[model samples]
Target: MKVSLIFPKLPETSTFIGTVKEAEKYSKDKIEFYGFPPMGILYLATYLREKNFDVSILDQFARGYSVERTLKWIKQENPDVLGFSTITTAGTGIISAEISRRVKEEINPNIKILFGNYHATFNDRRILEKYPFVDACIRGEGEKTLLEIAEKVEKDQNFEEIKGLTYRDNGRIVRNDDRPRIENMDTLPFPDRNLLGNVEYKNTVEGLELSVGKFTSAASSRGCAFQCSFCSSSMFWGKWRPRSPENIIDELSILEDQGFNNLLWVDDNFTISKKRLLKLSDLIRKEKFDFNWMAEGRVTQSSKELLNAMKQMGCKILSFGVESGSQRLLEWYNKKITLNQVYDAVKNSKKVGIDMILANFIVGAPIETREEIIETLNFSLKLDIDFPQFHILGIIPGNWIWDQMVKEKKINPDDCWEVGTAVLPIPLSEIMERIRQTHIKFMKRPSYISRQIAKTLKSRYRQKAVLQNIKNIERWDIWNSWKPFWG
Candidate 1:
């Protein structure tokens, strides 16, 4: 049986402006460039192809296909089963449902429509009940469960035995028992690069794209060891599981040979295993693999030794989860790190000569005072990181805050899939204004201006996007204030 997978295209950067830079797109397209590949679906495609299934991938997002064009292409493929993967963002789930509806109603109603990813996993039952088009959802990880579902569908057998699934029985929605998280990540095959076509990606920290040439992402591990209250990464990936240094090095070598000179380790926290990281660093140096890389890390999980080793191995950037500077707020967020730890990590990372350091801070958390928000801003500036991303705290699904909101009747569990993107503790206009002020106060300094100018001299793409982000902040102030009108 043939299988088809589709990924809806993401918005252009999701912040500064909605339009893609025509000149940049043209220049990049000449070299077969695009954003990061959807590793989730690519992994499933790999597993299915290994089992002798005819699988094809339609990356509508990377291809920049409109809904009509995507539908037309899907119809041409006309596979027995079609699947969609999505994350829980503002309008992503609703968009996925609409696409599923179009394929079912317009393309071929007989085709089985499957959904996967974070949004689908948490709202499986709700999706099945609300949308008649979505036949089933593979909750959590999809590799093994999706393969099992395909085998059953090919043979016209019952889907009841498949765990981590939510589907319809007759006319009613049925939720199955949870599936165990995949413990042996190394057992999984490398994601299907052939299915991904010639899409190019770049490794970057936060919104800053660092690599000048072709770049790609890797997962040295799965899941986050820390259960921060605002994040749902732990809920999805379950426990933390890091691949052996040997396995990780093998993938890096393959990517290096594949023309990927820069790499981004997309693990929840790349520095979770200090021992493993040091070993990986040593191996990378020993192998003489010439590749620049970056990874997300926690403030409490680094040392001078590790940072130096990473820099020596060509780690140009390191992003840290510095949610807040206030100790009270840190405790409330369950970040499990002291302010001292964050300060020390930043100092050590800078001392190690890492070219860039990104600090992610959350503003407008529930019950957060203005003083606390200001403290976070001041803390960020004092750290003097290369990049800082100030995000307004929203209730993320599968997180402690979301659960509390549901219990408190502030959010309807069944109908509030968009709560994560909406319902900020503070008004969005206020949040944006504070963020604008914070950015202006920290980023508009002479020193900061010099640093950005130097960076722009190095990266031509950064010149436009970075300046645009600063210029457009004022326009967003007016736009955000009028958000309700647009809604």
Candidate 2:
């Protein structure tokens, strides 16, 4: 069967915030050096192809296709089955549903529509119930599940026996037993990056395309050991599993040979284990490969020795999940580290000469007061880190926060598939205003300007990023108050 896997395109605009640079679209195009590859769908496509099925991927977000444009492509391809990889942000589920509905009702009634990824995994019953056009949801790791479903589809068979699937039965939704998580990371074939086509992916952190040259992303591991209240990482990817050092190095070597010199380690926390990271760093050095990489890490893992090893092995960017400034909020989020640890981590990262030190802070908790929000903003400003992203606390599904909201009747369980910002423990509008003010204050400082100039002189990558910012100076959405929270 001919299969088409798509990362649904973004809406033309959002009511929450404007783009960093105003354009006709709500997001930047890939040609503009923005966006990352939908690495998940690449796995599905490659796996299906290896099984002798004709498969293609349409990274709609990266391709910057409108709904009409995407449908046009779909109608032309007219694949036997249609699959979507969706996330919880920016109404992706809603968009994917619309596409599915139209495809079945308008394009082809016989084609099967399947959904996967975090959104589909958690809200399978809701999606199948609400959108009859949707054929099924492949929960969790889809490489194996999708292959089985595809074979069933080709044979005109029912998905009743397939594990990790939720589909319609006559008029009822039937959820099969979830498939176990893939335990062996090495067994899964490396995602064929060539399946990604000639598209150019860029690594831009905090509205800054700080990395130059060909850029893509890598996954050293899957899932997180710790469960942060607002995050769905642990739930979406059950438990933690790391690829061996040799396996990770092999992928990096292939990427280097593919002419990709920059990558973002997209693991939930790259430094979850200091010893493992040290081993990986040693292996990377031994390979003598040239790839500059970045990773999200935990403050508790910011040992000086680990930082030094990471830096020596070409880790230019190190970001920490400093979720909040308030100790109370941090604990409430189950983010075990302290504010002191955040400070120490940032300081050590800078001292180790990691080019970009980023801190992610989520403000406006359910019990967070106006004063507490400002305190967090002030905390971000005080940090020695170069980029700090302030997100309004959004309760996403399959997380502790979402469950709490549902229990308290703050959000209706069935209807609210999107991120819920109306908990109203603190008004979302108020938090957004505070975030805008903080961004303005931080960006307008002379010290920030001087830092930019100094960094621009030191690195050509930073120079290119700074030039992009300069060109968009008049249209910078920070002035228009671009609250970076997609949720």
lDDT of each: 0.77, 0.80
True lDDT of residue 273, candidate 2: 86
Off by over 4 Å in 2: 13-33, 451-487
Pick by TM-score: which candidate is best?
2
lDDT of 2 by residue, 1-487 (tens): 7999998765554333223222343344424325677779987898888889999888777666778888998998889989998776556778899988889888999898999998898888888888889989989889989999889989999999999999988988999998988998987778888876656665666655655667888898998899989888898888999999889888887888888888888899999888888998898888887778888989998988999999878888888999888999898999999999999999888778787888998876777777778889999988877878877676767799989888888778766675344464566777777787787788778998798678668865566667766775554343323444332
> TM-score for every candidate vs. truth?
0.89, 0.91
Number of the top candidate by lDDT? 2
Candidate 1 TM-score, true structure as reference: 0.89
The residue pairs found clashing in candidate 1 are 9-61
Q: Measured by TM-score, how close is model 2 to the native structure?
A: 0.91
lDDT tens string, model 1, 1-487? 8899987665443332122223254464432323566788888998999999999997766666678888888888888889988766644566677788988888889888898888788878777888888899889988889899889989998789999999988888888899998888789888857687745554333333455556777788888888999888898889898789998888887787878777777889988888988998899999998877778888777899988888878887789999997999999899999999999998899777776789999888766877888788888888868878777786757788888777878777666574354445657787777777776677668988897677667744455446655654432233443343233
